[model samples]
Target: MSKNVPGIMRQKPITPWLYLVPSLIVMFTFIVYPGVNTFYLSLRNADNTAWASTACKAGESCWGIFENYHYAITSEIMQTAFLNNIKWILIMVTGTVALGLLIAVLADRVRYESVAKSLIFLPMAISFVGAGVIWKFMYNYESGTNQIGLLNAIITALGGQPVSWLTEPQINTIALIVVGIWMWTGFCMTILAAGLRGVPEEILEAARVDGANEWMVFWKIMIPQILPTITVVITTMVINVLKIFDIVYVMTGGNYGTEVIANRLYTEMYKSYQPGRASAIAVVLILVIIPAMIMNIRRFNEQEATR
Candidate 1:
């Protein structure tokens, strides 16, 4: 009876993976499987016919690694798309974050702070595609009649020639950047305002007692204290700029030299019917965004650990 009791007392060892089964299954099905399939498809020829035939014959299709990648890099459209992406990142990220911070600071102490912020934040409520369409109408060009485009209308009213807003390659990029800034500035302001609220009033009062002017206090005191929030805002803006697709797609459709990485990917896959090339573009986009995301994660973790 003692031997039977001892045998029954022994319990089964716990399997660590038992707790992770659901998450593991979800990741495997959603992320891992799709990523592997995309990478495999990216190695095949443009039309996907060769890959389909090879798979039918031998249960697998494998073009040499980097062949599609090489083609994508060498292609003229892809090159232009890459350059446009760089331009978007530079202009959109800087403009939105800087302008948003300025506006946030100014509005914080204003008489009608809520009204000012609400008006600015209105654009953010609109979908990117919808905003693009609205801007497109506002930029419409006519040959003979007075321009209806808001910018051109003002120019014509001032006795200046009406310039094409979306047609001119150099100006078109800037125009698109303006739309992005309009849409995202509110997001930056909201985040920065919250950060501003977190600043201790006693510290600000101490600065005042030390005879620091408003400008000095802002630059030395407020800016340093809110640096973490600024980092997060800039990082978020960078990721958004990298993934920008809908506005450019709706406005220019990668035409008039306004091509971007995501737009180029869409054209390659759907318009040009080149799955391999599209997959290569997708992979490159993933590579570009991964570092930014990793840095943001690290910064967030560090902030949390410090807290």
Candidate 2:
């Protein structure tokens, strides 16, 4: 054997795993255990009354294996929540990405880039629940000179009627979405701005030398170069959107036509005490996220390989 082989043999074989032992223990104790329990609970009835009290052959109506799924699919509020999630995904993703990219490009060369970015990214420091409470006060709607919400106050000052920003099915969903955009836009901006910086100055100057206009160069060169980062940001936002609960919970409590999937899961599990249905909803949500997560992982791996 080579001299190096003897030296390697002298080293502790479990050294690498020694470092991993703590992490592995933590994962098993927390993440893996909880995940397994959630799945196990999902298979049982709400309160586990279906299987625990009797045999698995409990009557069709008495013990339904797929009954939770059926209830989740058919429930009116559940349906509304799912549809609202779709809306949330569409509108929030579009607004966050569009605004983030716009601000990133505009601030890329500004003298006050740091200050501008700091102001925008400041919201990222606040918790989602904290931002919700801040905006809830902003959307408050007490009448007369006592108007508490900034928005209602502004409208009143402008001689317009004070509108309820967080009520009314027609507008409440939109109201909640606005808060979400406010909280997340900064995060998207930071990621996208970093991506923009990665695009070499030399390439941009070369593109200009070839007579490409500002818009053309942006569309043809800068955007293409930054596309990977954009994809990662989008996939991340999609995952966030899929699991969005805090804003809806704080602002509306999933009431007045503003329920989303995660909120529904919370309501089912905690409020309604319907474990089976809640687990079903959780499973459905996991299914929806699987594809987006797979894409994100692939992109991440590709980036790692390139680096």
Candidate 3:
């Protein structure tokens, strides 16, 4: 046993690294290498066969070596995509978190709790593309005919004109965000429900005993205790909304002012065959997402330390 101890000690450090070799190789090949390559491509031309033009004639409009990034920042389609993504981040994130928390709290008091939760979470089981397709039917518009879309049918039934839910630039983005909220609210509810379960029952009871109303108990004691969970949910929602693509693509094809960053990136890469602009868009997305990811990690670390 004594002789074996020296040999075991020698192997211990290397043993963990040996286990990590496969994952390291995979990460470098897929994540790190692609990330670096994308950055390199962003500096090149549409086909990535040459460096982007940096020279300009006196009268010509040009963006120099960063032409791709210039297009991403200033082009009309990219601008629309950026604004729409910002709207998504604000509205979709808030709606999901708010509705999810409300439903979680209310469901806890209901007799059929499991049934309610199951129904709410049902949408999450469907893929985003599937959900988008289902809702597209719900939002479909056909003029000079009987309303085929459920929403339009309801409006016509109530003596209102049929509304174009997926088009007409003013309301289109809002229309798409509604689908996002519907799909993700269930997820937020499930996570928050778990956090709610961790609140100390004794603390809640004591608050009530001290003349705290139900609202007071929820606002003061319960909310603070579960705040970290709420933070996690909010950050998760933000990240998801930032990369929103499938729903926009399936439902709107990014038409009628519904363009989002990811969809625009797809359009540049595949349809326009502009690899450089697509790569620049991807890099921009990563930069935007990193801060949220870092915040989430720090929050998680704090929770672990407390544990």
Q: List the residue pairs that clash in candidate 1.
A: none
lDDT of 2 at 206: 98
**Model 2 ranges off by over 4 Å:** 2-4, 7-21, 52-63, 143-146
Candidate 2 to truth, TM: 0.90
After best superposition, candidate 1 residue 210: deviation in angstroms?
0.9
- Per-residue alpha-carbon lDDT of candidate 3 for residues 107-187, written as tens digits (9 for 90 to 100): 999999999999999999999999999999999898954999999999888888998988889998999999999999999
lDDT per model vs. reference = 0.84, 0.87, 0.91
Scored against the true structure, residue 176 in model 3 reaches a CA lDDT of: 93
Question: Could you give candidate 1's per-residue lDDT for residues 166-284 as a string of tens digits?
Answer: 87997998899899999999999999888888889999999999999989988999999999889888888888998899999999887899998888888889988879878988888
Candidate numbers sorted by TM-score from highest down: 3, 2, 1
lDDT of 2 by residue, 1-307 (tens): 4556867556577898999999999999998887777777676777786632232344444335666666667768888988999899899999999899989999977999999999998988999899889999999988675687999888988888888888888889999999889989999999999999999999999999999999998899989999989999999999999999999999989888999999999999999888877887888889899999999999999888978
- Give the clash count for each candidate: 0, 0, 0
Order candidates by lDDT, high to low: 3, 2, 1
Q: How does model 1 score by TM-score?
A: 0.89
